[model samples]
Target: MPLKGSDSDDGGNDDLARLLSGKHAGKHRRRSRDADDDVNGFPRLRSPRPRDEEEPATPTSRRFQHRRRRGFVLCLRTPTAVVLSSAALWILFYALSLEGGDLVSIVARLGILGAYLFLSIALFVLAVLVAVFAKGIPRKTRGGLLAGLAGTCVALLIYDHDESLYHHGGYNALIFALVVMPSLAVGAAEIAIWKWLGARRAAMCHLFALFVAIFVVSARLSRAAAIWGRGFGGETMQPLARTCKPTKIGLPWVDLLPAGAQNFWAGGLTCAPAAKPFSAEIDADGALRVKCPSNDATYIPLPVTREWPQDWKLVEENYEGKLPQPFNKRVMDAIRRTEPFRIRGDNAPGMLVPRTAEAAIVTCDGVEKLVLRARRSNDTSSRTLRPPEQMTGSRQTKTLDVIVVFLDATSRRHFHRRLGRTVKKLEQANADGRTRLFQFFRYSISGFSTGPNSRAMFTGTSPNNLDTVSPVWEDFARARFVTAITADTCQDWGASYNPRPAFHFDHEMYAPFCHADFFAEDSNPLGNFRGPYAINARCLKGSRVSDLALQYAGSVSSAYPDRNTFVLAWLLEGHEGTGEVLADLDDGLVSLLGSLDWSKTALVIAADHGLHMGLNFAFTRNGAVEHRNPMLAFALPPWLADSEGRGETLKANAHKMVSGLDVYATLRGLGKVVDPTGFDDPDVRKRAQGGKNLMEEIVPPDRLCSDAGVPQWYCECY
Candidate 1:
C-alpha cells in the first residue's frame, strides 16, 4: 500500500518493455490492430500519434544486440577451429584421390572404404567444433585469422604447383580448385552465420555439419558399393562352349598347282620314262615345254624363278653322257632325295627339270639328248613328269629378326574396345602390298602379372620355377644377335624377385624412377609429393619408358643394320594413373616400327599383365578374370608370313588356347633355338606342360589349366 515510488517504478517498467520489444515490435502490433477493423462490425479506434515516429529503444532488444555483437567478436578471436576445419577438408580430398597402393587381397581393398568413412566422421566433428568455438570473437581478430589462413592456402598451392597435385590442363587442377575454394568459403561463412544467429548459431551449425558429413559419406559409400559389388556376384570361372580342333597340315604348292596338273599328279601318269632322245625348254609362261621327236612331249607349269638349275633334277643314267658316271650317279641320287632342283646345262648332260622329275631331256645343238623322266602310277603315256615325293624343302626361309614389346598392365578388354584405331591401321598395313611384309595374330588367353608372364615369354618355360629358367635372349646373344631390354620399373627388371643377372640382355636401359620410388621417402604421405603416384606423374612428363624404348630401338637399328636384333621394349604407360601417357606409348610404337625395316623384323606387341584397376566390368562382374586377360598380337615378317601358309596358320590359330609359354615357343621357333626343357616332341609340347610353338598344330582343346602350368588360385580356364 506504500505509493511513495509507484509512479517512478511504473515509468521504469514501461521504458524496459519498450526497449525489449523494439520499434519493429510496436509496428507489428499496430499493423495487427489495423487489420481488426471488422472484428465487431465497427471500426476500431486508433490511439493518437506521439511527436516522434520512431518507437523508444527497449532494454531487452538492446541487450540482445549487444550479446550478438559479442558473439561475433568471440568467433573472430578463435582461429584454431578455422585452421582445423580447413585441414580436415584437405585431408579428406587427398584421401579420396589416393592411388598406387597394392590392394592385393579383399581385406586390404575393403580397408580403403573404412578409411573414407573414418575421414568423413572426423570432418564432421571438426565442422561442429568450428561452429561451437566460433561464437563472440572480435571482427578485427577474425579478419586477421582469415587473412593468415588464406596466405597458408596460397603457400600450399604454390608448393604443390610443380608437383603432381597441380596438373596443368588436367582434371587435377579443377579438383584442387574445387577443394580449396569451398573450404575457404565455408570458413568465412561460419563467422557470418555466427553473427547472425547469436544463441542459436551453434545448433544450426551442428545441423549443417551433420548434413555435409552424411553427404560425403553417402557419396563414398555409393562409389565403394559400385566397385566392390562388381566382384561380388557371378561364377568365377565359366566353361567355354567352343572346342579346339586341330587344322591339317598341307603342302604350300596346293594353292598354286593348276587343276590339270593336280589331277595328273593324283594318278594320270604311268611308269617312269626310259632313257631317250628329247629336248626340253621353258616357255614364256614359265611352263616346262618339252619336244621329243621320238615320243609324245608334255609341258608342266612351275614357279617362276631365275635360280632354275639349282632346283632342277636329272632323270636318266645315260643323260650324263659328257660327265663322269660316278659324278652323275651321285648327283642324281642327291637330287632324288632332296628339295626340287634346277639343272645347269653346263654342269651335267640332262635338261633342267623339277626335282620330282623321273625323266628329263636336253638338245643343246638341236640333236636329240638321251634322258628319262619319272611318272606317276597312272598310264596316260604322256611325257609329263611328276616331281619326286621326297622333295619337301621350302623356298622361303622361316627365320626372322624379332622385336617383342611388352606394354605394362594393358588388359585385352581395355585394348579391345579402345585400340580400334591402332587395330584398323594394322589391318590396313597387312592388306597393303608394300607392307604385305607383316601378318598379325590376336591371342585371347593372355593374362596375369608381368613377373610370371614375362618370365615365361623370355625363358620358354613355365613360370613355376625361376631358378631353372633360361632366357631366350641368351640364345639370341649366342647367335650374335643384338638383344636389348628396356624398362622404367625395376619390379620387372632388377628387383628382388627379378634379378638383373638372370636376364640376359646385351643392352639394359633402366628408367631412373619406378613404383618402388613412391614409398622411398618416409616423410611423404600416401598420395603426397614424394609418393610413387606423384613420381609417376612427374616421370610421365619427362623421358618416360616409351622414350627409352625409342632410343634403344634407334640405337640398335643404327649400330647393327645387318645383324639380327632382338629387342624387348617394356613400356609402363598402361599402368594405373599413367593412362594419359598411353598416347605417347602408341606414338613411340609407330615411330619404332616406321624406323625399322619390317621386311626383316618380326614384331610382337603384347602386355605382361592385364589392367589391375579393379574397375573392369568383364573381370569384376564375372570373377577376377580381367587380371589374367592381357593383350597379345604379332606382326610377322613377309618371308615367315608367306612361307608354308604361315600367315594363314597364325590367323587360324589365333583363337586356339595359348599363353605366354606358347609365345616363348614361337620365339624359339623363330630363332631356331632348342628348348632346354628337353621336351621336343610336338605332341608333347601341344599338351602345354611348358612351351609349344603357336605356328604348329592346334593346342588340344582339352588342355587343362594344370597342363598350362597355371596355378589353381589364378587360373580361370575350366
Candidate 2:
C-alpha cells in the first residue's frame, strides 16, 4: 500500500521503493491525507515566502549554468564562417595590390568575365547544397570534396605565382604569408565544420552561407576595382603629330647612285668584296693613262689633274662618254637627261666605290677620292680599278689582336663568385706589374636582347633596322687583320641582321652545321645525354665552341703572328645549368687565356645578357633593367695602355655608365678610323649614333635615354 496527499507523495514513495529494490517499481499505492496537511503528511502551515527572502544560488550551480550558456554559443560559432572571412580579406588585399593596368588587360585578354560569374554562382549553389544536405553526405564523399579543394588551392599557388609580384620582396613575403597560411587555416576549418555538421553539433548552418556570400561579394568588388583603376577596355590616345627637321646630312656618295642603285648598294651589297688595284699604265702627263685588258682597249689620255673637275665637261670629253655603248650610253643619258650631276669631290678611293652602279663617289678616312663607274661588259663582276698605294696597310702603329669571349647569359654576380679567384689572380698580376693584360671594365646595360646587344657591339649604332652597318670587322679586314667567329648558338645572327659572308667575318663556324642523324655514331655514343648537353662528353668537358675557337685563334695567331687577328668565341654553356657548366667555362677560359700572348692581344670578356638565377634579383625585373647591366671586362695590350694616365682613366671609368655602343666606338678608335668629320676628334661625341670613343672621353652624367639610343619602350632611367 502507498499513502499520498498528492502526486508528490506518490513520487517520493516510488523513489524510496526504487532505492530499496535497486530496480524500478511497477506501481505505487496511494495513501489519503487531511486537506490542511502538506504532501509529506505535516499540517498545512505557513504562507509562501516573499521573493526577496528566497535563498541565493550556490557558487557551483552558478558556474555550471554559465558554462552551459557559453557551450551553447560555442556550438553556434561555425569554423567555416571564420575561415571564409579570413579568405575574403586575403583575396581582397591581393587583388587590390595588383597593378590596375595589368588587371584590366588580364580581364580583356582571358575573356573570362562571364565564365567567372558562372563559377561564382555555381560555387554558391554548391555551398547551399553543402549546408542543406550535410547530414546526408557520406563521410568519404565529403572528405573527397575537401581534398579536391585543397589540391586545387595548392596547384593555384604554384602555377599562378606572379613573377612580377614575387620580385618585390616586402610585398611578396607579406602576400605569400597571407595567402598560404590563411589557405591552410581555411582547409583545417573546413574539416572541422564538416565534422560538426555531420554530428549535428552546428546550431546555425546559415552562418557559413552568409560568410560565403560575403566572400564572393568582396572578391567581386576587389576585381572590379582593379579593372576600373587599370583603365583597360578604353580607347588609346592618339599621339600628337610632331614636326622634326632632319639633323643629319645625307651622304654625297649616296646621292650619286640612281634610286634603284642606291637601294641595291645599301641593302644587297653589305659583304661585297673590296676592289683591288689592277695593273695600269700612267701617261707622261702624270694622270692620263687608260688601258683596258679586254680587247686591249685604249682611250686618249686626259691632262693629269689632282682635283676632280667641278663640271662633267672634261669627263664627258675625255672618256668617250658621248658614245652610245651599253655602259657609256647610260652614263651619258644619266648625265645629260636627268638632273645635273653634282660632283661633290674628287680623290675618292676605288675600294669604297660600287662596281655595278652607273656612277659612285667613294670616300675613305674622311677624304673624298674618286667618281667612277664600271665599263660596259656582259659580265658585271669583271670590273678593274687601280687603288692608291697609300690607302692600304695596318693603320695602327703596333699590331693589336682582339679576342671577344661571349659567355651567353652569364650574370655578373655569378661571374664574380665562380671566376672571382681567377680574376683576382689576374688583377694581382697587373697590380704587381707582372702583367699589363687584364683591365676590368663595366657597362650600364646589355641592351634588350642578344641580337640587339651584339649588333650594338659589332656596329657603333642601335639596332633599329637591318640597314645598320657593322663596319668594325670590315675595317679590321681592310687593315689586313684575320677575322674569325665560332658560335654554339646561331639564333642570334638569324634574329638580328643576318651575318653577311664578306663583312661579318672571314671565317664562321656553327656548332650544329651538320645533321644530327648520326650523333650517336659520332659523339655521344652512350645516348644518355639530352637537351643542350647532348654532345659528346669530350665536348661537354671542355666546351666545344671555346675549344674550336681557341684552335682557330691559335692557327690564326701562329700563321699571322705579325698581322693583327680578330676572333670571336660565343660560348653557349652559360645560358642555363648550375655552377658545373660555369666551372667548365671558367676552366676553358683559363686555358685559352694561358695559351694566348696577352702583350699583343686585346681581350674582351662579356655576356650578351645576364642569367636568370637565384642571385641577381635586382636586374631580373621584366623591363629593361633585366636586359641591361651585363658583365663587361677588357684586357688591353701593354702597347695600347702606354698612354699617359690611361690606366687610371680606365680604372676610374670602369664603374661609369657605358653601353655596347661605347665598346664599338672604342674598338674603332683603337683601329685608327677617323670620324666622318675628317678628324680623329675625341671630343666630338655622337651619343645617339654611339660614336663616342670610350677610351678617349667619359660619358656625361646628364645623358638621357634618347641620347643613349634606348627606345622609350625599354627606357627605365628617368
Largest TM-score belongs to which candidate?
Answer: 1
What is the RMSD of candidate 1? 25.7
Model 1 Cα lDDT, one tens digit per residue, 1-718 = 3234546767767776676789678778655644553222224344646868644556544543464457545443444556455556745544454332332332244346434434543454454445445654455755665565456445544534332222211223333443444564676677667667875876788798999988966666454333321210111122243443322211112112232331222222122333454545332222344455433333322221111231121212111133332212333344345443333333323234553332222333233222221122122112111123312344222224577877777655445333444655565566663244222122333324566777667654465565544466666655445666655443334332334334434454432222223223122212322322221232321224355446555555444443456777776656643223343354556566667666676778778666554223212332244446566777766766676676676655554456777777777777652112322333333223556676654566565555566665555542
- Where model 2 places Cα greater than 4 Å from the true spot, the runs are 1-397, 432-442, 490-496, 499-504, 511-555, 577-581, 612-626, 673-688, 712-718
Best by lDDT: 1
lDDT digits (tens) for residues 357-416 of candidate 2? 222222232222122111222221121111344235543335567778877666444455
Per-model TM values vs. the true structure:
0.47, 0.44
> How many pairs in model 2 have backbone atoms within 3 A of each other, for residues 3 or more apart or on separate chains, i.e. clashes?
14
lDDT of 1: 0.46
